[model samples]
Target chain A: MSEWALEVEQLAKKFPGVQALRGVDLTIPRGVTVGLLGPNGSGKSTLMRILAGVQRPSAGEVRVLGRRPGRETKERVAYVPEVEHLYPWMDVDEALRFTAAVFLDFNPDRAEEMLALAGLDREARIGDLSKGYRARLKLVLAMARDAELVLLDEPLSGIDLISREKVLDGFLRGHRPGETTVVITTHLVREVEPLLDRVAFLKEGRVVLDGEAEALRAKRGCSIEDLYREVFA
Target chain B: MTWDFDRNRPIYLQIGEEICRRIVRGDLPPGARTPSVRELAAELRVNPNTVQRAYQELERNGVLFARRGQGSFVREDPALVGRLRQQIAAAAARRYWTEVAALGMSPEEARRLIAGVIHDDKSSLR
Candidate 1:
């Protein structure tokens, strides 16, 4: 098996009017949580989309779990979009039951645990749920699946502080070291700084800096949030 | 289970220091089992790997030990915890001493300042 959960090299993506990525290279070892951080327009989501196989890179190579991203790799990878994608008509329990039925790797027990941890009501209708609860519910959906590589795109975006805490707290409880590799992309650096084992600073569709989170803090003599400010300053 | 961190320093180091502080404060008595990494990480909202690193460091420094298939525990020896307490105290004292020295305070003045603070009330120690 490849040591890296993800590897991207000379990767570039373009949409007729704009370039989303420009020759980016990144590699993350398995069993670590990575913060793919940058400003909103820095291509963080685009990169995530490509890795998730929802979109293809316009230029270079992409690998998930040492193989090209496809049906094979998709089995071991779980991708959560930045926005809420759950159906509003379905209640929390219905959504989870549907997911359990659709995805082979989904675990109902794990879903139950995440539901409690996220403080989500199983019978609450998706339309009646709070924004934060909806966000947490989406995460629970993704996390319930026992994927080797989990891709979370802006998990903290547009949520209140208390709800964000619940989302992060839920994620922390379910994440076991040496079992899954989590890649989280966010422009809000401070809130997720502590959960990062590694971080890559994306700017202008390229990685300007990347390193071990604690080592960067020690070397820069500042927090990752400050470092982000300086990089994009 | 609350956590406080300094943004300027490495969190794992701060975690290790915090654990030491807990031991000295008697909040985590010697021979007590430390919270499992997942539980602590969940409570702290930090990466499990970072928590693991802190536990490994504590084990390396003799403040903790782990049993296979079981969680880590604080060292059973009371003397070990006592020495650890002294080390922490010494570090804080050295920092205060250095700051006072920079301000041109003499040894006599420093001694008198400490004596007066304690003499004023026992609660001042807290």
Candidate 2:
């Protein structure tokens, strides 16, 4: 088994007109919570998609759990996209059932616990649920799986403070350090700063800064949010 | 207990100082089991790694001891506890003196003000 949960070497992605990732290289060790931080158009979501095996990188290599990203890697890696992907007609319970049916490692009891933690109603229809509740439901679905690597893309985006707290609490509840590695991407640095063990700052499809979160804070004498502003500004 | 972390310093150091304060204040009595890193992290809403760093620092300082398969506990030495209390007091005094000096107060005047505050019945320590 490899020491790293994720490894991306000279990874690049090209769209029809834009080069999303430009030879980006990153390595995340197992059992650490890493914040994948960057502004929009910085290729955070594209890197996540590539790691999740939903999209292929145009050049270079990507690995999850020491294996190249494939069906096997997908089994151990759970990816929560930035947009809502659940069927709108289905209720929360149906969504939970669908997730359980898809992921063999999905724990129904744990899912229920997470739903309660997030204050989500199991019987509420997905379409009728508010944005916050929908976000919570999505988190519940992603975290219910006992995957080795969990990638969360913009989990707190567009949610109110109270809802964000609920989702964060749920995420923490489901997290098992030294057993599972979590990679969360978000532009809201201050709120998630306390939760990150490491951070990788991206800019224009390239890694600008990456290091242990507390070490960076100690060296810079500032919060990660301030560091982000300085790096991007 | 609630932790208010300052953004100016690293959080693990703050966590370590907070735990030390609790120990010196007797809130976490000698021989009492310290909360596990995960429990404290969840309560503080901080990363578990940060909490682990704090625990490791405390252990290195002889404030806490860990047993195999069991959780950490406060050191049972009363002498060590007394020394820890004195250390905390000295740190607090140094910080107070520095701030008073920064305010341009002379040593004698700062002493008089501290004495007055200590003896004043109108003020609450809290």
Candidate 3:
């Protein structure tokens, strides 16, 4: 098996009017929490979708957990998209049950624990829950799965400050270090700065900077947020 | 315990320094079991690898010792803690001196000012 949990070589994706990704090459090792950061239209979402096995790459090769993004890889990879996917009619309990039914790796007991930690009501309807609660539920669903790789795209976006902390705490609580490889793509650099083991800065459909988080900070003599601003500015 | 991490420096170094301070302050007494890397990472909301780096650094410095599968612990040697405390104090003094020197103050003048401040502060006596 490859040492990397996710690997992309000369990956390219083209839309009708825009090139979403252009010859982007990246590798994320197993058991590391990597922050895939970039501005809008920087291909973060496109890369995430490809890794999740939802969208095929227009060109180049993509491997997740040493295999091509397909049924087997999808089963081992848990993806929480930027958009809400939960059925609005389903309550928190129903959503958990649905997720458990869909993925054999889903841990219902762990989901219950995460729900309590997030202060989410199992009986609350998905439609009635606040945007933050909905986000937390999504995180809980993704985290409860014992997937080898977890991908979260803009998980903190649109979340309130208080709920954001709760959700972040829930994430830390659910994740098992040295066991799962986590890739989080978000614009909130400052908030998630500390949690990143490695970081890859994407720009205009290409990777601009990729290195260990602490090494980058030490070399640049600045925080990740400052580095992001300098790179994207 | 809460740590204020500055963005300008490496986090692993900061984590190592924080644990050093805890050792000096007796917060982590000699022979005390240190929190696992996972636990510390969760508490600080940082990457476990970062914590592992810090712990490895500390271990290299002889400030911590790991007993395979049992977990890491503060060095049982009191002399090790004493030496670590002295090293930290010396580094702090050097930093203070550098800042004072940058202000064009002589060593004598800096000493006098420090003495005056300490004398005026009743809490320093404790």
Compute each candidate's TM-score over C-alphas: 0.94, 0.94, 0.96
Report the C-alpha lDDT of model 2 over B1-126, residue by residue, as the tens digit: 446799768999899888878887888999999888888888898988888888888899888898877988989988876887788899889999999999999999999998998878556654
Instruction: Give the per-residue lDDT of model 2 (tens digit) for A4-92.
Output: 99898999999999999998889999999999999999999999999999999999988889998889999898899988898999999
What DockQ, on C-alphas, does every prediction get?
A: 0.85, 0.74, 0.73
**Cα lDDT tens digits for candidate 1, B1-126:** 447699789999988988898999988999899999998888787898999999999999899999998999999986987897898899889998899889999999998987887788877765
- Please report, in order, the local distance difference test score of every candidate based on alpha carbons: 0.90, 0.90, 0.91
| Candidate 3 whole-model C-alpha lDDT, 0 to 1 | 0.91
Give the runs in model 1 whose Cα sits over 4 Å from its true position: B98-111, B123-126
Strongest candidate by DockQ? 1
lDDT of 3 at A180: 94
* Clash pairs (backbone) in predicted model 1: none
TM-score of chain B of 3: 0.90
Q: Which of candidates 2 and 3 reaches a greater TM-score? A: 3
lDDT of 1 by residue, A1-233 (tens): 99999999999999999998999999999999999999889999999988988898999999999998888888788899997788999999999889888779997788889999888888899999988889899889989899899999999889998888888888887776788999999887888999999999999999999999999999999999999989998
RMSD of each: 1.9, 1.9, 1.6
lDDT, residue B27, model 2: 87
Best candidate according to TM-score: 3
